[model samples]
Target: MGEPVNREKPLRVGIIGCGKIVAQYLESFRRLQDVQLTAVADIDMERANAVAAEWNDGGAGEGGVRAVGVEELLAAPDVDLVLNLTIPAAHAEVALAAIAAGKAVYGEKPLAATTAEARRVLDAAREAGVVVGCAPDTVLGTGIQTARKAIDDGLIGAPVAATATMVTPGHERWHPNPDFYYLPGGGPLLDMGPYYVTALVTLLGPVVSVIGAASHTRAERVIGSGPREGERIPVEIDTHVTGVLVHESGVLSTLVMSFDAVATHSSNIEVHGPQGTLAVPDPNHFDGETRLFRLGGSEWETLPVSAGYVGSGRGYGIADLASTPEGQEPRAGGLLAFHALDVMESLLDSAHSGKSVAVTSRAERPSAVPLTSQEG
Candidate 1:
């Protein structure tokens, strides 16, 4: 690939959503020297104005980063990229719009609500000659990267299998706007499987086929927090999902994603080989402890952090994408995100059909992050 893009200049960015997750990206942008926040936009003018007012304080100069309508922001000549934090349903629409405007785009997880939509986004970017990046940049963090280093270094002889487990009572218990969690695009697997699937792809490789089964326990959920507290939302998708993925490299990964369960003591993910087993940290966060157990060892031993962007979080992917050469894929590029989404969607298809589903999309494993800190 071409040499990494120079980091001396900042990438001018415009954000397109102003929801709860926007706060995390805003916080990250403050510490990421390679990015410059220039504008904010949303369907709700009030929310857009509020976010612009809060983050633009003496930052963008002159008008100081005022809020604009989505169309205005998309057409802004000064904006080099669009940060799409909109809900899953709107992801592809916003991305296609930005690409049509000739701007690179980075978005929150699952890439799009469906692989067909995600494919369109990628195709549009290719036609527009703009880059596409997606989140759960959490994989670029030390947690998953360190575990990846162990497997790459032969701490695990030859990866044979893996298991990923995530369970919670439900997001309605805590999320302020929890209606989306019960929608078709918001089931447990689609909602949270991105992290686990992406981590597995990072550690193992792209999956080729999958078999799945799923269940839904409740028809409605009560909002337990925010303005919607005590509000009941209808559930339209499966709440619990299980699947087994066969990776291109022949490694098998068992997955469990649930919104109906009480809890799980299992490590977020565990990979096994002939010589050892590895306990990888949660893939939703940037840093954590990774432990390893050799076949003959009596107890698990914690492994030191050896790779990834140190002290990184949500928006690191944007910074990483900003520094990637024009023609190269970002470490958190859309291809990997598309692959993960395809895997999840296929799993759900298998669940409904009671048969194995083949994954038609694939992604090359992203380049490993060396031990490095953010340049500030």
Candidate 2:
């Protein structure tokens, strides 16, 4: 990459989805002076308007953000960037719209409903000469980044083996609309798997092959909390998934994700090398702390994570660009995001087909260099 360009102007951004995640995006955007969330859009006019009011005004008393449709948001001349927070199925359409409109794109996870769609988005972005970014920038945060640095620095001799586990009872227990979690594109492997898998790819490099098994443990899940009371929803996707990831460096990463099991121990991703072991913090934030444990040592040592990027709150790119100025290359752009998305697609296929799937694309590790904040 060329020497980082210093952005001298504010970035005018438009958000194209309105929901719970929007609040988190707003929180991150509000902290920055370099970006302005000038517009928002959603299918629901009322919800869109409500959310816009908040972003425009800063809250109930404040003159919140404004809302529009996908087309309007993309066509707006002031919009330097588009934050595509729509559902998985709508990712490709929104992304294409933004890129074709000559705006950069930052989308939510999975990149799209399927691998084919993700490829289309990448192709479009490449043709448009604009940047596109996908979700889970959390790995770029200090917690995971610091651990990755230590491992690369040989605090842990070349990583030989690793493991990550993420389990939850189910989203229907809390999510008001949990049906999507069990559909064609919805499964433990594709849903919560990104956070853990992306962390692995970023830390250990591209996976060479994956052997796996998957199943749906529960037919239905009842809501435990939320306004939707006593709702019994069918589980159409795999509730649990397990796999072995063989990295290019010969590191074997064993991973398991489930929506049926409640794990007792803390969820973790641990990489073991000849010298020691490093436990990465949750790969879902801009920064935090980590732990290091040597084989001879009896306990885990707390390692402070040195972070320079602020959590833009919600939008993968928004959180990354909260402190970034206009016209700067997005730190979480399409190239790396596409690699992560491709890896995820390969994992899901390996699980469903009971075959070892190889990653066709090798994305550079997720980086947070372009964005700057007070180092902590």
In terms of lDDT, the poorest run of 10 residues in model 1 is: 1-10
Per-residue CA lDDT of model 2 for 31-53, tens digit only, reads: 65566678888888887898877
**Top TM-score prediction, candidate number:** 1
TM-score, one value per model: 0.96, 0.89
Whole-model lDDT values for every prediction: 0.91, 0.73
Q: Please give the TM-score that candidate 1 achieves against the real structure.
A: 0.96
* Candidate with maximal lDDT: 1
Expressed as tens digits, the lDDT of each residue in 240-261 for candidate 1 is 9999999999999999999999
Q: Model 1 segments beyond 4 Å from truth? A: 1-8, 58-63
Instruction: Give the clash total for candidate 2.
Output: 14
On the 0 to 100 scale, the lDDT of residue 106 in model 1 is 92
